[model samples]
Target: MSHQRYEADLRRLFAGFPTGVSVVTAQAPDGTPWGMTCTSLCSVALDPPTLLVCLRAGSPTLGAVLDSGSLSVNLLHQHARSAAELFGSGAADRFDRVPWVPARHGGPHLVEAAHTIADCTVTTEQAVGDHTVVMARATQVTSLRRPIPLLYGMRRYGSWAEDMENGFLSYDFIS
Candidate 1:
């Protein structure tokens, strides 16, 4: 297969797997808030509360995180689809239009877009291919009770639902 076709196929395969959406935010030295929408976030540890966030190697957010040594991964709720689209664009003043409050650490904590705000300090970072995977230790966390989390799948934003149709629970039972 051609390289372009292979890349396209891989992206299609990836979109089939549902993932939650998040926005990673950090601060520059001049107290400017930098953020980017991403789905490449996951918990790596439980004992110390470690999270891994992957960002494009050339992203300005990555640079700010490196410079400030801190970040906040904001887990978006289903209502924040518009906020996601705003952050995903190349707008230089993305934060100017969004509602956010300053985090004690550095970055701005998005008020309504997120259900959980994890303020972390970077412990390590490695360049892998075209992205930089950052491993950070959560220094503080703010979580809110929410009904459903925002989801990304098939190149769209939505939420997860239980399948309750078609005569469910039809597996043969021995009990």
Candidate 2:
């Protein structure tokens, strides 16, 4: 099989898996706010509280984090579907539509839309094909412990309806 075929298969397989939605936010050196909805965030360690976010190559938010040297991974709640949609678009000013406050770590935090957030400083980064895996040491991590988190599956935004007897429960896997 071709390498491209393997990549396509991997994408399809991952897309079929349900995942939490998050908005990775940061500010440029010029104080411009930048954000993008991401589903590729993961916790890397616990002793030092490290996390990593996989962002598309050449994304402005990636550059912002690299410049600012910090980021906030805002985990969006179920009600933030619209916000997720907006930030994930090609709009010139994504932050204009959302209510946010400047994060202590030089980023924007959508307090109302997020269930929680993790502020971190960039420790390392690596290019992974079309994406960059950014490893950061969390400076502060906050969680509301909300019951429901925004979900993405099969390339669509959705919510955690409930645990049904019909095998329609939420997938317990996070990648």
Candidate 3:
């Protein structure tokens, strides 16, 4: 297969995997807030409460996080596509159009996000190509909204609804 064909195939393969969308935020020096839309966040452990987030090496938030020594992961709801787009944009004043409050960990937390996990100090950073995997210890967590989580599938945002089972298989099945 040719290089172009390989690239297309890789893209198609990745398109099938769904992921939860989140906005990772931190405050830059001079009190400027910065954030980026990311889907590369994952829970690494529960014993000590750890998580990992991947960011591009050249992202503004990356530098801010490193400088400030902390960051916040805001899990967006299915209705927050606009907020995601705003943070993903290249605009300088990204926070000017969004509502947020400072977390107890000193990171900015999206006021309306479904949930937030604020980390204090990065425990480890591993370089991978043009991106870096930042592993941090969760220092603070909060739930700001009650709703279905935002999902990314086929490159779009979707919601999940609970399916209730009608009266059917029950009590007598074990007999």
Q: Global lDDT of each model?
A: 0.87, 0.86, 0.77
- Per residue, candidate 1 scores C-alpha lDDT tens digits across 36-109 of 99899999998888999999998999999999999999999878888889999969989889899999884689
lDDT of 3 by residue, 1-175 (tens): 9999999998888777777788998877667778898889899998788889999998889988887878888888867877877877867877878888876564688887545555455788888989989988888777666755677767666665555476342211100
Q: Which ten residues in a row have the lowest lDDT in candidate 3?
A: 166-175
> Which has the greatest TM-score?
1
The regions of model 1 sitting more than 4 angstroms off are 162-175
The TM-score of candidate 1 is 0.89
Q: What is the lDDT of candidate 2?
A: 0.86
Model 2 lDDT, residue 156, Cα = 76
Relative to the true structure, candidate 2 reaches a TM of 0.87
Which is superior by lDDT, 2 or 3? 2
* Candidate 1 local lDDT, residue 79: 81
